[model samples]
Target: MKAALMYGPNDIRVELTKKPDCPEDGLILKIMAVGLCGSDIRNLTSDSRKGNYPFIYGHEIVGCVDEIGPKQTKYKVGQRLFLFPGTYCMECDNCISGHSENCENEHVAKLAGTGGFAQYIAVGGEKIHYGGIYEIPDHVSYEAASLGEPMTSVFACLENAKIGYPDTLVIIGAGPIGDFMASIAKTRGAKRIIMVDLNAHRLEMAKQFGVDEIIVSKLDNPQFAIDEVLRLTGGKGADKVISATPANATQAQSLHMVKKGGLVVFFGGVPKGSMTELDTNLIHYNNIWIKGHFGASYDQSKRAFALACSDDFPADKFITHILPLDEINHGIELTKTGEAIKVVLHPWDESFYP
Candidate 1:
């Protein structure tokens, strides 16, 4: 099997590795397509996974069941599938309370050096029974199905905010995740959608994706975006604000961008051990609600897959580049330069590269 192993920060090499064996109670997937996520870039640039170096790390996976375990009865060989990525213990306190998304003993199926970056990954043990795999629909393209995992988080965030008709939704970040937030919010009947970002080129590209307005934020003058959001909302502020960038400035600006009694979702996470100073008076005097979102629930993952399968979701448009597995470094660079929206890597397609 050929896998891209992360040796350290900003270092990745593609080399031959032993193929993972199928778990007695699990299965092995021949990875077809895997989408590069923002988290992957973050991990690549930092030592967050220092001790776990030289391991595979992709999670937005779409593959075919190459080999099935004898104990696995639900799926058959050669069936195409999408990964939910994370699994949880049913006996955990969070799982018992029906909030398995917060399970204390959660296990990521992509871990243990058998992630989607490889040509073949073995998913076995408790992960199969706890829910991390779903059969892909025949009509959905592999590239689109690879986006299901990221879309699940978007669905979870919107569901938490209860965004609906006549709500002015503002998303801070013009990347793929922010675009997903805008797309889902539109389907939920948001009256107006505004996107803010530091990249002017990214914001220009976002216009075709159903964003009602785009604000080019200034890193030096952070208040410029706040004023622009207020001006666009007729001085009332947006009804809901989602800080989709992993920047402390944007996260703090979300509070001032939303109207009184509105909801603010911190969709992007800041660096570990870093804290932002926010005005508590805004929450106390204006009756604001601030929420922090992380992973998605099983139900949200299912809904995200169904939505990706639908014709209305524009899943294909989200994919801007497709590359071979060996070119993983180039793919990562494209994402960092904002030259690509979503890059899907085909682990087995060594002959084709774009």
Candidate 2:
């Protein structure tokens, strides 16, 4: 098997590697498509997490079951499936409370060593039992199914915020995740959806995804975005605001972009040890709620996968590029330029490989 091994920042090499064996309680998947996520890009560069050196980095995965563990009765070989990027212990306090995303003992894809940037990955042991894998419907393309992981977090955030009719929703980024937030908000009956971003091109692209308004903000003019959001909401501000970009400025501006008593969801994470100063008086005087969200629970993942399979969710439109596995560096560069929305890598597309 050949895999893109990440040695350090801006260093990923595609080379022949030992194929992962099927686990006694799990299975081996031959990766079909894996989405290049923003987090993956971050990890590739400055935001590297503490993990084993030279590990694979992709997580948004859709693959076919190549080999089934003898003890794994839930699925068989030759089945197409989408695997969630994170795993948790079902016996933890958070897991028992239905918040498995925050389980005390949890591991993401890179930490689990089952990254999908390769020909095959071994998934087994307790991960299969906790239900991180789902079958892809025959109608959903492998490229679209690869977005299930990110979509799962979108579902979890919207469910937590409870955005609905007559409520104006404001999203603080125009990237793919922010676009997903806007689209899902429409189905939840949000009266209006406003998107803000620094990239004019991405904002233009977001117009097609049910965005009611777009605000172009500059780093030096954060208040301009808040004022624009207020103007769009008839000076009352939005009922729900989501900071979907990994920038502290957007997260700070989101506080002032919401109406009194409204909720603000911090859906994107900043670098470790980074801090942002927020107005606590806004929370105390205005009765506002600020929630920080991360990954998705198993139930949320299932619902997101089902939504992706449905006709209403435009999964195909979100995919802007598809490249062979060996072109991972080029894919990462495309993502950084804000030129691509979702870049799906086809590991088995040997025709395109050089």
Candidate 3:
């Protein structure tokens, strides 16, 4: 087996490694495609997670069941599947309260050595069935199936914000995740979708995904963007404001872009120990809701899979570049440079298109 192992900040090596055996109560997957996520980029540079070193770091995964454990009756050999990377302790208060994404103890998929970056992986954790894996639909492309993980979190954000039709939705960041958020906003009843990004190319891409308006973030004057957003919303601000960028500036400005009594979703996260100041009076006087969302649960992952299968979702469009595992480093660089919307890696170098 071969895997891209992250040794430290900006250090990842593709090395031949011992293959993991199929767990007696779990399964083994021959990885087909894996998508690079923003979190993966952060992990590559500097991640504050507990299991943070000398591990593989891919979560958006699609693979074929190469081996199924004796007790794993829910899946079988040769089945295409998308594996959820979140491991939650069912005994946690968050899990018992149905907020398992916030489990007191969470082990990301990569921490267990089953990161999708590898040619093969073994999944056998106790919480695997809870929100850790799903059968990829027959018609879905491997690239599209790999998106189930990120799309699940996007769905979670919308669920938390309760965004729907007729609401003006403002999304800060026109990256792949932001594009996914725009794609489903109209379906959720968003009357007008406003997308913001510093990149002209990404903002242009957002236009194709049904964005009603586009605001280019200004480097010289950050408040200029917020003023433009307010003007676009008729001085009332957007009904739902979502910060999909990890910039502390975007997160802080999200409060200023939402209408009174509206909701603000802090979808993207900044670095650990980072802090931003917001107007306390603004939130108190406007009665606005500030929500934070992270990984998705089992049911949300299922819904995301359904969304991937829908004709309107256009999951394929999200995958702008595909590369063999040998080019995985280049793929990661492309993602970081904003040169590709979604960069996918094929561990087997096989045909991945539908």
Query: Global lDDT of each model?
Result: 0.86, 0.86, 0.82
Give the CA lDDT, 0 to 100, for residue 207 in model 3.
84
TM-score-superior candidate, 1 or 2: 1
Ranking by lDDT: 1, 2, 3
Per-prediction TM-score:
0.96, 0.94, 0.91
Candidate 2 lDDT tens digits, 1-354? 989999888889999999988898888999999999888888888627455688787888889999988888888889999988777776788889998888787354333434789999998767776667789999889988888888999988999888889788999988889989988889889989999999999999998888989999987878899898888888988899999988888888999999999999999988788887899998889899999998888788889888988898998789988999989999898888778888889988855422
The TM-score of predicted model 1 comes to 0.96
**lDDT (Cα, tens digit) per residue for candidate 3, span 258-313:** 99999998889888788978889999999999888887765676787788867868
Residue runs of model 2 more than 4 Å from their true location after superposition: 47-52, 106-114, 351-354
Looking at model 2, report the run of 10 residues with the lowest lDDT sum.
105-114
User: What is the number of residue pairs that collide in model 2?
Assistant: 0
Model 2, CA-based lDDT: 0.86
Alpha carbon lDDT at 114, candidate 2? 45
- Model 3, position 28: C-alpha lDDT score: 89
Error of 2 at 283 (Å): 2.2
